[model samples]
Target chain A: EHPLWEQIGRSFVHHYYQQFDLDRNQLGTLYSDTSCLTWEGQPFQGKAAIMEKIASLPFQKIQHSITAEDHQPAPDTCVLSMVVGQLKVDDDPVMGFHQLFLLKNDNDKWICTNDMFRLALHNFC
Target chain B: EHPLWEQIGRSFVHHYYQQFDLDRNQLGTLYSDTSCLTWEGQPFQGKAAIMEKIASLPFQKIQHSITAEDHQPAPDTCVLSMVVGQLKVDDDPVMGFHQLFLLKNDNDKWICTNDMFRLALHNFC
Candidate 1:
């Protein structure tokens, strides 16, 4: 395990949720204009499209409790992070979730190139 | 898009479903014994664990129609494939799904090292 890669993964997870909760606009800096997000099977390309999808979420507030995570440094300074967590959406039942991120190290800064998120419900939530 | 990688992705998607439908036993050959799988959030490690999880699925039969896919060749001869598709499970409502595979090219043979699968549904279905 690459310690530095794992550190980046942890920081990304922490900062993403914090920024998202404080102000989603702040989270835009974490992603590039060309970044893409896969929400289950639907695709959202570009930060503008990603923000639109984020804003359309059914819940007004959400919390993420990361339980397990792993990271792998890929070629071309790319990093793959897999996170397993519990999601609390407003007052709803705590939901299980899995998120994968492909990050690119650009100018000593890490930027998310691709993100994928899905619920853990067997029946799908 | 890497043409060869994309071709591999397509073949992997096709054969995975075909073999899974015919005989789950055949599917085990595609994954290494130490392979890991993330179903939404929960984790399944090792081929035995993965097969157990697959066998426990509620659906007796399932069909996968891959609609979109992307493949990136990573370091260490690993290929990352992201797939978006529609799933039909024993006459259940057609479900949208996203699957990610981290495959390692071992002597020209692609073996899945990490697999993730999730269904797309807004509410618990």
Candidate 2:
């Protein structure tokens, strides 16, 4: 991780979780107008669609345990992170997730442009 | 995965492994002129840069065991696949990798635009 980007990455993720934990309704503010999200197998673009996807998630309580995080600087900053955590709506097994985020830093704030999340396991075995 | 996309996805992965196994140099043909590749935490763009990055990998033999694949249809088709497998140069442990591929279908062929890869494990334990 770049020295400057490490700070930005840590702060960006911290701020994201804070806002998300408080109210997912405000999640739209973290993304640009043209941002996109790929959750599970579905893809949604723009704020309205992205918001709808998050709001419809079956899990009401989500806890993310970040295992590894890496940052790359380019046309846009990309952070690849791995999380093995638990999510509960009623009752669910602990699941693992691998996420990739593409963010743009504008006016000292980072805005996500592309987000991808999928199961961490390659096989049940 | 969509029915059509499933076939495309399987064939794509198959062809990729075939070419990659034959010669890493041939991997460039699978991407467009303006494609981008994010290997581990490093980002490389364009054919020259992407090729350079692949050709320089420490591994002499790489095998990707795709665990799950999901496809989304849009302006450009995006396939999110999780792979956990091995990489070896002379003698190396079987390292697991998670990869995401952003593909565009043009002229009845799929071309990768953005490829991201990261470690699958969040914690070593």
Candidate 3:
């Protein structure tokens, strides 16, 4: 597995667990300023804004199991698709949602520039 | 411009005009049964079902301009991305939304197998 993949996995886990213990600044540094995140049809732009929005969600605990992942890399751009299995609040298995992450390589690190996802509520109910 | 491109452009225009005057059945035949469409936040499956759902919408007039088009063709699959400018009902020029169409070549023709889009409402409002 690539080191960046491991980092992404850990970041997601940390965020899901609301373990705000991790350095929040790292999230902004890892994602690009132009990044667009659409969750359940709600749009949030930039890493700092998205971080604040997510932090505001009233979730006690959360976990995600990545079911499938596909990554395509070009010289400067990377497209990633993953099926995520989410467990939240009432311990309900929120089926799975598809997430497409578009990343651009800056210097030597990958920073997400576009993030699109379908929510469980939109898919199941 | 490719012949297939012209056909797609025409089909979209015909459907948008509420030219329910056009062959409605052709819509079903043009799209694959497994195609997925998400409008706003609601998800719909299959061409037949999607057509039905669209027909039920209370729209007086609709028009779309293709702002951008990108097509990548493999031996068996074609991926298309389009930015569509929509004009609907109240004569408002809705900002464009991105639509991704995944098509599989069957026999000699192409049919959409996966259709993913960010609706105007989801993107602008």
Candidate 4:
């Protein structure tokens, strides 16, 4: 709710997606040992496990176009962010996706502590 | 990450949707003055304002069918839950939706501290 939350949240989201699209391997800088990620209902914990799953994402080329996003400050100096966006993989058609991230400041740098991601499909896949 | 988070998250989601579908007015019991909600990019703070928005939702009858959900324990004993689901409003076609809630215990009762909601449409609306 504070103005600082908006600044922090926007900056974090920008850095996250930019790094994700450019080089997902660099995303490890945004997580730590206690980080947890739920990608399409599959849960992965810790930086190593999460990075392994991210690196094996099945696609070589991808781009994300964000449609809308909301950010709020949560308890304990954490920022909660939700994103609705479209992603293009290889030659595949653009697919809608929704993601949420809970970020906390560690050593003055924002690190993702929790993440949830899914393709916005009508039926569960 | 913790088993208790799953239990608490599942229970909270069940009660939340049931109350939402049955009587949205009763949904206020899950919020407080410090709560915040971002409903489709529109931000509302506190119980009174949030309830006003909920009460004015354009549809009289609605039914939600959850497709998938994920829950994890966050900092400071908070539970973060994300839900992917479909909802039918009145006689309209079913629409996909994604929502996230940050739940924390206050006086032994779980209260929603932050909520984000959006309908899964390809284009931002």
Candidate 5:
């Protein structure tokens, strides 16, 4: 497997760990120090800030399964798409999500520059 | 090149032709017969409806440059990201756009199921 593929796989595992146990340390390394994580225009910047925000989430447990994965690569950058099935709060299936990850290669390591996801939960409203 | 790669390249060329001359026909085939194209919350469904919407765009001439491309593939689907530089309307350099394409392969051909793009134009406003 290409190094980029390994990085992406690692990122997903890290996400699973964080989601299952609310492990802040596992989640922190996935993002850059200056990275920004936004949901519905609310931005959380930096590792500490992002961890704090995630730790504050009311969900007790999360189980995410990647139903599909796709990648498009240009030179050193790649975009990853995952159709995610997530179990959140009360262990109920909240919604399906489509996530887009924009990654760049920095010093032979892949780092996610932008991550955007949409939930089917909105359709229920 | 894999068949999937060819399909992706063809899609980009099709996009350029549509953009350059306001060609409605070229634009219509890029999407599925039951596809949905949405910006903000406005959704355009089906081919004829989407073409009508594009034909209404006031841009006279458009030039688009793809600064980057990336792909991720799983089974039969792939996601593409294009950092597009566009010259639109009145020959002004309006802004850059990041376009995300979610594609599915049906019977050996690829069709875009969803397309999302963000314009730097919004940042200026």
Candidate 6:
């Protein structure tokens, strides 16, 4: 295990959410052409498709408040992170959510390879 | 993308939860010496340590009901799966949780290389 895996993972997650809350348009820079994302059961592949899906989200304003997070180093040297948090969208009440991200190093820069998000509500499905 | 990744991912997840709910003792066989798990923010490496943690859970009776699941084949050919669901413990009310797994093929058999789990309760932490 790399001694810096935890630190790198934590910092990457912080940067990700910060960018997401501030301006989702900048989120695309954190992904690459080979990236994939599953948002609320919908799947999108590649940078363009993923960015399109993100930009099309129905919510106008969103803020993520992380309650807990876990990180691990995969055998392939990628960082696997799971984040448990609450989010406020527009004027709606706060809702809980779970998100997972697999980040890999590409030319000395960390980029997300896979991402999955789901709302943590009993009746949401 | 592998044509059978989704099917394989779904089957693997079904088998995993089935064994977990029916008899966690059998769960050890699904992991390998290099497998890693993070349960409720605690990290455990290798199969023996992971199994020890799983067997030490305080709950006597537990059941999981999955509401949604997402799967994607990573660039390294590993299957990344994220599950959102509810669980019942003893006489406690159903509580939402999120679990993630990365399954890799080894010697013609799929084994869980990484696992992360967390409860989705507000005010619990």
Best by lDDT: 4
> To one decimal place, how large is model 3's interface RMSD in Å?
12.0
Query: Candidate 1 — which residues are off by over 4 angstroms?
Result: A123-125, B1-10, B13-99, B103-125
The digit string of per-residue lDDT tens for model 3 on B20-108 reads: 33433346665767666655435677787878876776665555555434332212234332333344344655544445554555686
**Candidate no. 1 TM-score:** 0.60
What is candidate 4's lDDT per residue for B6-107, written digit by digit as tens?
A: 889989988999899999988998999989999999999999999999999999999987889899989899999999898989999888888899999999
TM-score order, best first, reads 4, 6, 2, 1, 5, 3
> Can you give the lDDT of residue B61 in candidate 5?
65
What value does the lDDT take at residue B42 in candidate 6?
86
User: Taking the tens digit of each residue's C-alpha lDDT, what string does model 1 give over B20-99?
Assistant: 77766668778877787878656777888998888887878877787666665544556667766678889788777767
Off by over 4 Å in 6: A123-125, B123-125
lDDT of 5 by residue, A57-113 (tens): 776666555544444332233434333334345556455544566555557666555
For model 3, fnat equals 0.00
- Could you tell me which 10 consecutive residues in candidate 6 chain B have the lowest summed lDDT? B116-125
TM-score of chain A of 5: 0.67
lDDT of each: 0.73, 0.62, 0.49, 0.90, 0.51, 0.86
Q: Write the per-residue lDDT of candidate 5 for residues B1-125, one digit (tens) a residue.
A: 64565457556645644554564447666677765454432456666776677677776666555544444332223444333334345567555544566566667666666554444332211
Winner of 2 and 5 under DockQ: 2
Per-model TM-score on C-alpha atoms: 0.60, 0.62, 0.42, 0.95, 0.46, 0.93
Give one digit per residue, the lDDT tens place, for model 2 in B1-125: 45675566667766776677668888987887777676766778788899888888776776555555554432324543333443334466555556656566768778876676665444232
Predicted structure 1: lDDT? 0.73
For model 3, the stretches where C-alpha displacement exceeds 4 angstroms are: A1-26, A74-76, A90-95, A123-125, B1-125
lDDT (Cα, 0-100) at B21 in candidate 4: 97
